[model samples]
Target: MSVALPRIDAIRDAAARIAPHAVVTPVMRNARLDALAGAQLFFKCENLQRGGAFKFRGACNAVWSLSDDEAARGVVTHSSGNHGNALAIAASTRGIPAHVVVPEGAVKAKLEAIEQAGAVLHRCAPNTPAREAAAAEVQRQTGADLVHPYADTRVMAGQGTLVLELLNQAGDLDIIVTPVGGGGLAAGCAIAAHALDSSIQMIAAEPEGADDAAQSLAQGSRIAGITANTICDGLRTLIGESNFEALQQHGTQVVTVSDDEVVAAMKTLWRELKLVIEPSSATVFAAVLKRPEQFAGKRVGLVLTGGNVDLEALPF
Candidate 1:
């Protein structure tokens, strides 16, 4: 079977479909940040979105896109945190059951949020294989559709909608950057950005510890040897196959930032913009800072992917 990647039209449709549910999150700017980065930055604040993350957009789209029978059967997926919570909340909105397989040591606050949204949680080992097995078992038992966090077409299309909204909201941007984990959001952003304006360059920020997307893009194929040991918890996964293909086709650039750099960016975001963002979200800022010459005097748009950080486990 051939792959069915996300398309621009589908992304536009996703924007329309999820409009009522997901926030049209504000685009913020700070003079201090501009001076620091030497770029006019537009921050798409998905941190303020429902579930406190952009994951809600894709999860909502997937849950709602289901046929009546599928929705009735409900949805199942595996996630470290945000996506699971988003899926649980999305299913709750449609009055459908949701089963989430989460790793044993997932974030406390996020796991609590998932449970609070009424999802039945299944615990597994913190590896991809374990999570997949647990989710498959849940789907087998419950007859729920498996909505792989970053690999599903519906999810990728839904993720593209954020860039669609950002381009409309942020005016003319010379560059757009977002953190890449499993590559759903980055791939989606690349598709939408390239479709809207081929001139706009796409960049994906990744943790140095989990630089699979960067390595994959360099090798012209997927590379999966890197064991994730990043503080950017949300960006520790290997890029999905479709996501890698999308990035390769769209000509996206991947920049790797150290965990320390991510932490510094997180602090700057809090101090300069008064926004509480997680380390994964901070990767974009780190990217810009990593290469100030590339972004200088340009209108750069950054997607603040999520803000689901544990207060007690503060890195700064």
Candidate 2:
């Protein structure tokens, strides 16, 4: 099960491939956040990225990586929200059709955005197996290229592009933190950051209720079938196989935080940084706040994965 991880060159290629479409996304900072965390915190605001999440980077790369014939046949994938919207928008850019298999209870706003992007939506049970099966059926019928949300190498390479932009913008960072769901962003960041600077540490923040990534890393094996019961809806997925392989290869660290802690952190970011981010994005700050000693006096970079929150349901 030796998975070949995306190399720095592949990330560079992805960056070039997606440059015309993907946003570079700003790296921001707040002195108040620094004071509270006892560290210099740099936030990579992918919430402002097109389609409102860092998922666009991976989705765009995956969509555009296809050959002309593949593009003509179009793309299909299963996503809870952000990735679906991203794939839809990305496919639209190439003037191709996109098929998104979304769970029945997916956020209304996200589903609307996906449809608005002109992608046809297919609904299934809100579980991994059902989602995958529906997406596979779509591909079988439409003769579409299946673009997995996170597991594909092209998607990983696209995600790695975010690290490339972050390191360049933030300069030397001691550590980079991102919330882990399917482990796409974390794996990509780990690969790119380690390639750029071997000493740079990569850390993943996970919801305590969905701590499979943390447990898997600690036990030296992938853990599955744990029911996710966290407020961070976007992070309730089991880690992807290749993504786990990348994390293990890079020796990435994982920290778990409770839903309450995520809410508190989310509130702090909204108040201090004036940013509207989802609970999944808040996990990075929550992790730093939970373990101050780990990041004290260091320059830490946090990826605000998305801002696709339901305005009607404010956790604060």
Candidate that scores best on lDDT: 2
* Collision pairs in model 2: none
Model 2 TM: 0.98
Clashes of each: 0, 0
lDDT of all predictions, in order shown? 0.91, 0.92
* C-alpha lDDT of residue 120 in model 1: 95
lDDT of 1 by residue, 1-316 (tens): 1146888988888888888788999999899999999989999999999999999989999988999999999999999999999999889989999999999889999999999999999999999999999998988898999888999888888889988889889888999999999988988889989999999989999999999998888888898657999999998888888888988888899999999999999999999999889999999999999999899999999999999999999996
Q: Against the true structure, candidate 2 has what lDDT? A: 0.92
**Model 2: how far residue 71 lies from native, Å:** 0.2
Error in Å for residue 195 of model 1: 1.0
| lDDT, candidate 2, 1-82, per-residue tens | 2245688999999999999998989999999899999999999999999999999998899888899998999999999999
